[model samples]
Target chain A: MRNVKGPEIKSVEDLIGPLARVRPGRPGGEVSGTGARTLLASVTAEEPTGRTAGDVPVPAAVRRYGLRRLTLGAAAVVLAAGFVVGPSLLEDGSGGAASYANSAVAIEREGGDYVARIKDPFAEREEFGEAFAALGLKVGLNLSPASPGAVGEIFRVGTSGGGVGRGFVAGTEPSGCSPSEPGCVMVLRVPADFTGEAWIELGRQARPGEAYRNHGSAVGRYGELRGTDVDGRPVEEVLAEVRRRGLQVEFQRIIVGDGGSLSFEAVTAGEVGPAWTVWDAEAAMAGKVRLMVTPEKLDDNPMYEPGLGPGGLDDLGESDEPGKSGEPGRSGGG
Target chain B: MSDDRPARFEAVYREAYGRITAYAARRCDSPQDAADVVAETFAVAWRRVDELPKGQEAVLWLYGVARNVLANHRRGETLRRARSAGLDAEMADLYAAPADRGVEMSVIAEVFRNLSEDDRELLSLVAWEGLEREEIATMMGLSRNAVRIRLHRARRRFSRALAAAGVPFGMERRMVPAGRSL
Candidate 1:
């Protein structure tokens, strides 16, 4: 077949014009609230038992029947447990998830997984340490004094070990708070078998004019950072300037994909100097900056899928700390 | 009094329902499957509302969730829930033929279908969703550079595929602005 001259695609948008043309479906305004309500009830189980319009008790038998009807054949035991626990948590509506006002920590069991909701952003770090110590399940959220610009921001989050992971917090906002809203309440899902901590660094709301350090952005290859500091400077220049200032720089090679480019991250262990601040301002001008520097790297951003994390396991109890296996405080960078 | 979890979730539901439904309807083979995808996607969203992105980002964030849900359904990782009845009924209405939208682009579709899933998705995000590289990066949890490079490669591969499929040069070049090439 003679190769025909193709379209001179100017942008990514133009490249797949035909595919877009052929793509099926447009927005249809027919979504019912049933699915949302059901899932909400299952997650929170906050309604009165079997009485509220939203909360329906999901019996083990019903789940078993659902499993059998689908004939998944495998994972029947797991799915049955999920149907039972997930809906049951909400069946009573107000029970199951434990709340501690002292540490502002609330622990609830949903779908066999333990979800720790940090009700108080002002709770001391050791308080969390205490809560995890008492529960025998470790969960981490690092609240630090934030820069005036980043007050109440969730700068970075890290998770480690198997089964234990952190929730996805959208954009620059914290896990629970909306973008415009102040205050951050973190919700972390601990796997039933997870014996380690999922550490998160949140920017405590700063008083006006207070100076604070900001965490670096996790920039992927070709990721651009906008602001006066980095608006037009080449990547090489930014790195060179950082090194010139006698600061340590690290690079994480791209192990995934074609490995065409390297992962770019920079950080200072202490407060960000005036030099870094320039770059941050410039980068923010463009968009969320991409230099994933932190005072310390406590956790790898977990790959949190939709639905709660580890909602099917049930064996987690007050086990002793598993030898600091996933401590975020020790991982240093700023 | 302000709404509680269900009410807050309902607001998000109303805002994102149409887009998510369209996403599922386009990807799933049947209304039932679409229903499952929609139901499961919203269920997941409702469960994680506190963590959901605010504003328009919520919709894009949801695309990521729905993508995962669809993958699970395709892999048979999810149980068929009776909760999808409402979705099934709603999608049934949308199962109607999308009027002659792709007739002229049929050949393009054929060539596009020959590409890999990643490439197809990258291209679709640009063309179908009209997301810029930055938005695509955020949506996919990738760096903007990765998106840019990957998107560039995807377009090149698509152009090659189109040429191999014997599409006319003028028609092909028509889509690309002047001075642009594969």
Candidate 2:
């Protein structure tokens, strides 16, 4: 293939010559009649509920937190039993009203910012919004299901309107505090005078059939494949382990292209034979794992084949240790 | 500390509008589909403004988002949400414009279209968008070596297909190293 050089081929650009001629002119400027402005407005006006109608009722809290709306009787009963307490107001050092706390969240003034610590990640979304509303801010908080490594991490921060100074910052209280430890809490810091409408989405433990909005390696300590290295293992062995864990499995056939380049194609279970080797595993959803397999064993695990530091599982290092925090505002989801 | 998201997004939209529109126009089958992809891409950028990277990287990030949006559009998952008359008109004009379609170019276009979606995208990102390997890695969420390997394979497949079609390798020699086969 190397020595057979013909005169008809120049470059990929030449091959795409006239077909690349489609050039739509720029959309009108920021405020112009082009759909750009309208689209901007529509997206900016969107709330954090993942609904376009802007009127969907806030979803109920997940069952794991074991929390419910505190009715007058329920609140008094819980208080008497010493199982829970009502919201509390905390004053700053200067004796000013600077902080507020509820059963689900606590908002306090720290330096020039107000920090809201989530006490119950599974609390109803409305409870979070109400806390911010009480403090005269328009911030909305939604905690979505995520893999173990992403728990308590903020997935996205979106804001609109004006008067939002420095916007907001979301992180754990003790910096790298993991949700698995006591005294660890996910916190969001907002400017004291922030008056704009903002939407914040954080990660929480996923429920059955709830897809993870973000993920880490399945082989990490907290991952589903933890303590079980599936890499280079035969398909039957991995499938047995997956069934033992009561988890579903999917397969992606690894195709070695010319020059040893690799690509993957999703294949049905029947298409795979027990002799196929597993190259890597990914957290496909709450209770599912996707295995990358090949018909025969290769020279090296393609996941780490390119010598690019653990393939695409950069999260493995950060997510392996307990109580280790990930980078703030890590990019994931759409 | 000031809220400058709106301003920042506006600047990026202005700078990237044409390039992104052309990207959508190239992949989409119709003017409306192309317009919808453009609109949805920007809308997503606006919502995730804080995550949008700076300067040149921002365009690459937008391209990444546009790529996903295009995929969703192809799967019929994305609704025709952000349509406007102005965008529709612009896309229609772009698709309607005539091109210098020589017979050779036509044959090449057919062959290119016959390639898998992944191959077509990898090739176009190199030829049309003129993106480097690193930029493509960032845009596609792959390692640099992965992009290199995939690009090598895509090029080989394209050249072989061209050869099979009787299109001889022509005037300008590609910068393949002397002893390298592909």
All DockQ scores:
0.16, 0.14
Off by over 4 Å in 1: A1-9, A22-99, A103-115, A119-124, A138-140, A144-180, A191-334, B1-111, B130-156, B159-182
Q: Which parts of model 2 are misplaced by more than 4 Å?
A: A1-9, A23-33, A45-334, B77-99, B171-182
- Cα shift from native, residue A58, model 1 (Å): 18
Give the 10-residue window scoring lowest on summed lDDT in candidate 1 chain A: A62-71
Task: Report the C-alpha lDDT of model 2 over A60-159, residue by residue, as the tens digit.
Answer: 2111110111111111110011112226654545643356777778887776677899999889889887777666667799887767755775544556
Per-residue error for B119 in candidate 1, Å, reads 2.5
In Å, residue A162's CA in model 1 sits off its true spot by 9.2
Candidate 1: residue A109 Cα off by (Å)? 6.4
iRMSD per model? 14.0, 12.5
Model 2 TM-score on a 0 to 1 scale: 0.40
Each prediction's Cα lDDT score? 0.44, 0.61
Grade the docking of candidate 1. Answer: incorrect
Name every residue pair that clashes in candidate 2.
Answer: A6-B169, A7-B169, A7-B170, A8-B168, A9-B168, A9-B169, A9-B170
For residues A4-50, what per-residue lDDT tens digits would candidate 1 score against the true structure?
11223234344455343223234643555565445445644443222
For candidate 1, write residues B6-70 as lDDT tens digits: 67666777787777777776556676788777776766665565556555667777777777777
